[model samples]
Target: MSEALAVVETAGTDTTVPAVSGARQFWRRLRAQRAALVAAAVVALLVLVALAAPLLTALEGQDPTTYHPALIDSARGGVPLGSFGGVSAEHWLGVEPQTGRDMFARLVYGARVSLGVSLGATVVQVAVGIAMGVAAGLGNRWVDLVLSRITDIFVSMPLMIMALALLAIVPNTFPRPVLVALIIALVAGWSTMAKMVRAQTLTLKNLDYVAAARLSGWKTWRIAVRELLPGLAAPGITYAALLIPSNISAEAALSFLGVGVKPPTPSWGQMLTSADVWYQAAPQYLLLPAAALFVTVFALTVLGDGVRVALDPRAASRLRVGTGRRRENRARAAVPENALPEKALPVKSLPEKEGPA
Candidate 1:
């Protein structure tokens, strides 16, 4: 009987372990997404570099804004600072065309601008979206109708055109990067995030847990905050992660169009804008910033996809099928590494009594 109990307990443990760890399970799921994992690493590295830009520039004793006109090669139409215009001891990525500012320093500093705008806008967008979405989802039909219509109107409007029009009216004295982020967040992000949140809230508000909370006399605010919010986190975060790259790209485009962070600020888009004029003389100048932008966007996109898959087992299965990789790894990812498989759990055998005769 004791041996049988032990076997039953072991089986129960196997079942219980999987349900216990939400964070750990999410991590295991994420680990299965190889592309997403790689993207996350790259994003982390880029962020570190962006954060360390000041330290790196200080170490090099180079000011990004300071022009080294003498370094420019006038003999070659004044495009490069050196013979090759790339990978030199003094300048890692070579100098700007005419200004001759250190390429490495500008690149690093530019990352700061790009990241700052993107991250800031994303935060605002997510917060506003979540608030409006939750409100709409949990509210009565009239409230939902009003908010949903508003969201639809915003969604129908062209974001770029509206932003451009608004930006043109704003005073130049106002901060460009901050202003851009605000415009982008207000115009582009909230609608989509709100829609997603609303859809999720509609589903979650009717769940058993929510019913339990309501039955316990929890206030509406408490129910929304405690019950629905937790359920919304996975989708909200995944959407926000995906939104970041779009925000970054938009900021860059604005800068490229010359309405962004003005000259001497050193943004990726600004660099591209300037590089285009000198492309014939030094194509490296054009390629460097473009490549950085591409990498940043790609990494964010892949990381977002990974997070989405991590939170949803169905998505993970689809990812596995699309990738056409080894099935064993995907199987491992779906299950927590610390937990033993049902077949692997130790079994205690019952002792057999020997016959007396």
Candidate 2:
């Protein structure tokens, strides 16, 4: 008995479960989400297409700026001559209604501008938001007050009006896409991210590890960089993912308003601006850019939601959504039969008492 007990003790002591790193765990969770995976694939394709725009355009034998006047019918209000907006062997998508610029070339090139502006704007917003949020959360009372007020002021400002004013004032010499991105980042939206970060910081600062770090005489900067930033990353990333689609839409809106990327530059919004007039005569012109914008935005939104669920599984549970049903089933299957709850186990009924024996 003593030997058996010793063996049991040694076996128990030696048994160890391997620890999973956060990155691996996150990736594992993200992979389980089918919608997220699909969305990721779409976003990847868009990025790939955007990066390969020049090569694609070269192969199509068309440049976005070159106009083929012969393809347009002046009798029909400058509409493309052939069916479906002049689609042919040469033009995979079709030609523009009036200018006869290759739709495929303009679309791929437009992807570059749209993606670049939104991505750049998102980066700027994240940087500014993190800086402001962390400062407000970690700073003294007076510092917090000032930052909070500043954030409020930013939130209160009308984004469209501010963007228009700024865009109007800036010299036209600067690259329009870059200028639009900067304007979008500066105008509004960062306040929400800042607020979220600030709240998270406040909660994290009061935690035991943070308190221990402070007691160990670590400086504010060091503690923030080492301790607080890691905790902030999950939420920050989730928020940033959601922010991209919004920024893209905002850029499109700006372009639609004639204050966005200027002509000769093929932005989806600018395309839409021109497409409006040709909707009745050549509906294909309007549909193409609109569909592209819709798909990109929809994919991004779904991906963001998946990312949010992956980063915080509890969030899915809280919403009563079955996002992890497959994961849950796999987990359950991995557990030994004996480890299952008693309620889940088969129960044998006791022999019924003989009646009137």
Best by TM-score: 2
lDDT of 1: 0.86
Model 1 clashing-pair count = 0
Instruction: Please provide, for model 1 over 6-59, each residue's C-alpha lDDT reduced to its tens digit, 9 standing for 90 to 100.
Output: 223564573322233668789998887788889999999999999999999888
Off by over 4 Å in 1: 1-19, 74-77, 316-325, 328-357
Q: Write the per-residue lDDT of candidate 2 for residues 1-357, one digit (tens) a residue.
A: 122122233645854444566777789988977788999999999999999999999998998999999999988778898888889989988899878899999999999999999999999999999999999999999999999999999999988899988989888899999999998997776898999999999999999999999999999999999999999999999999999999999999999999999999999999999788889888988999999999999999999998998899777623226646867898999999998877756889999888995
Give the Cα error of residue 198 in candidate 1, in Å: 0.9
In model 2, the runs with Cα more than 4 Å from the true position are 1-11, 317-357
lDDT of 1 at 203: 94
CA shift of 251, model 1, Å: 1.0
